[model samples]
Target: MAPNMADDVNRAVSGARPRLIVGISGASGVAYGVRTLDALNDLGVESHLVVSRAAAMTLSQETTLSLAELNDKASVVHKIGDVGASVSSGSFRTLGMVVAPCSVRTMSEIATGVTSTLLTRAADVTLKERRRLVLMVRETPLHLGHLRTLTALAEMGAVIAPPLPALYAKPASIEAMIDQSVGRMLDLFGLDWAPVRRWQGMAADAPE
Candidate 1:
């Protein structure tokens, strides 16, 4: 192949790399977000991470890793307040957005279209652009209001995927369990990760 043609092909392939927006809100199980970034890196997907202020505090409280280290895991880290960032625009193509360990406050804000931060703004852009918006909502013991908000989000095409462990996968450790859930979330974007143990099937006549 000609040198110029080879160079053009390389540029095309580089430009076609898949991108996804990852949001980490102030919720427990921040490991989910951390592992999501790790998985994306493994899959060669460009991850645009936006960490909320409350999530920053949660990260400090829950993990020994510094915020700088967390940011380094992502391909691009956008400021929480940078609403004008590329991710906040619909024209910026991406696979979609995932709010790992999504806080109820963040979910509610996205559902209402009242995005107060770049994280939520990117989510709103995802929804408006008809792109997949997956929410790994962490709150449990949902009341009527929380349920209603989640329903509204679902109705508007947001995926409500809580990070539930696939006990069937029989995760040997907490990290394995977290990887299983993060793998499932990535599946929604059609990016398969190695940690996801695929369910084959039970023996037809072995058990009830």
Candidate 2:
């Protein structure tokens, strides 16, 4: 049976646990997606995760955790090829979707609406539903085409949040930097994470 849209809507309004779809593409920063799941877990949000094949390769190279261990972090794990998953429908009624470490290929697929995987397909669904779709784009040294693609996606209501470190937070290590960026991404969904060092203001000093 198809999921009851009404029930999902009611649950959303009745303070039920919020749901967010997490997509991990074949970007360099797999740690961003991993920490996103961790933050969601800490916030009590139900996470629906879909990781790309290339991401599996990147994960193997970048981190010690196996794919199974990474899947264990999510509330629900959707296979990359499972286009028929619950998150693939707008009626699932989620807070929205976040594509952490969003790769150029995945972002382009989403912009073109020619999604080849469940990861991009779910992102497409998020956009069509007018929900907040935040893409933490991970590429650097972008050329003109990349700029244009990002512009198009921005026009389509997707937030292009590059996971740059918040130097203002005075992060002590690389992990702190990652957490800060992850926290800010969660902020888009109005989810407050403890590790986010919100700016208070310039401290009064004699710099003048």
Candidate 3:
């Protein structure tokens, strides 16, 4: 069993903010990953980021920011191929792993236990260590393979979250929508967020 880093931290270290590992796959919703890192940083959570080669390609095609500028947003950044990194080990405790905009290819790899890169390895380590592993899969028009992989991962304790919007939030802009989605994702990990409005329901006294 992996030692709980939260439990083992000294008082001095324990005072530091929690760390979360954010991985970006080659999926279309790179925006989700970028926005998620920004939101986590805003919440004072330290983030370690890893971007796959395909993800880098997509990011370049989709966003104006350079990879370095993107990496600067995170507290620490690791290359996707760096399997020797601290995140690949269970000893380096993290709050959890979130693969925002996870591609179908990446999901298949995770499902099959294929750790060709550090991102996959870290995810694998997360599962083996029984830590929270959330994958925000971004594919649309899903196929049988995608469904099977999602099912397998879910069975293995991975949360397969897609980048679907909530109709109730009634977001005004793309940024707002992204924020709401990221906020909902964080909620899965028991993190409170103020990025989007929460549902308070109708006032009890005023409601019919």
Candidate 4:
């Protein structure tokens, strides 16, 4: 690398604000990832987003919003094939990463460290740095292999949080349920979101 280019890279990284890398894979619930970016924006956290091609297909099928509409929610958007992207390196620095609605395929790729795409490569970087990496795995009817893979990831220091709605929140609508789930995930990064249905105590909500 050239001297000037090195200086530019250093300046860019040194000036980086608190940020989180958001990954969306081809999973059933794209909204979890979408709202995750929105919540990060709400909490004044910069979001770097990368979406798999399969995820783009899933988003079109599940929501009326276009791809640009979803991309607009993020502070920075990187091409999935761009392995040279800033988030691909641990030197870039971030709060960590959260792959909302993480697909089984993506999870398996990250677990084995056989990263073929920028999405998984960035996840590999996060894990290597010992940074918090949360995977909102959205699959169901898990077999033994899936369970074992999840265990391996947990041992590797990745948090596996399935978006199971907290029934105790007594959610009135699906959107509320989604928010509650997303908010709780943000809690892992030490971010507080108002929509979280926090458990106060046995009589948690007995009017102040």
Error of 2 at 33 (Å): 0.3
Better of 1 and 3 by lDDT: 1
lDDT of 2 by residue, 126-182 (tens): 888877889999988999999999999999989999999899899999999999999
User: For model 4, what is the error of residue 88's alpha carbon versus the real structure, in angstroms, after optimal superposition?
Assistant: 0.5
Model 3 Cα shift for residue 21 (angstroms): 0.3
Candidate achieving the largest TM-score: 2
| Residue pairs with backbone atoms closer than 3 Å in model 3 (clashes) | none
How do the predictions measure up, each by TM-score?
0.92, 0.93, 0.90, 0.90
For 20-128, candidate 4 gives per-residue lDDT tens digits of 8999999899999999988988988889999999999999998898999999999999999999999999888777899998999999999999999999999999888
Question: What's model 1's overall lDDT?
Answer: 0.89
The weakest ten consecutive residues by lDDT in model 3 span 3-12
Candidate 4: where is the Cα deviation over 4 Å?
A: 1-16, 204-208
C-alpha RMSD values across all candidates: 6.7, 4.3, 3.1, 6.3
Pairs of colliding residues, candidate 4: none
Off by over 4 Å in 2: 1-15
lDDT by candidate, in order shown = 0.89, 0.91, 0.85, 0.89
Q: Put down candidate 1 lDDT per residue, 1-208, tens digits, no spaces.
A: 1113233224324568888899999999899999999999998988999999999999999889899999999999999998889999977878888999899999999989998999999999888877788999998799999999999999888899999989989989999999999999888877889989989888788767
Which candidate leads the pack in lDDT?
2
**Count of steric clashes across candidates, in order:** 0, 0, 0, 0
Worst 10 residues of 1 by lDDT: 1-10
TM-score of 3: 0.90
Look at candidate 2 and tell me the lDDT of residue 15: 55
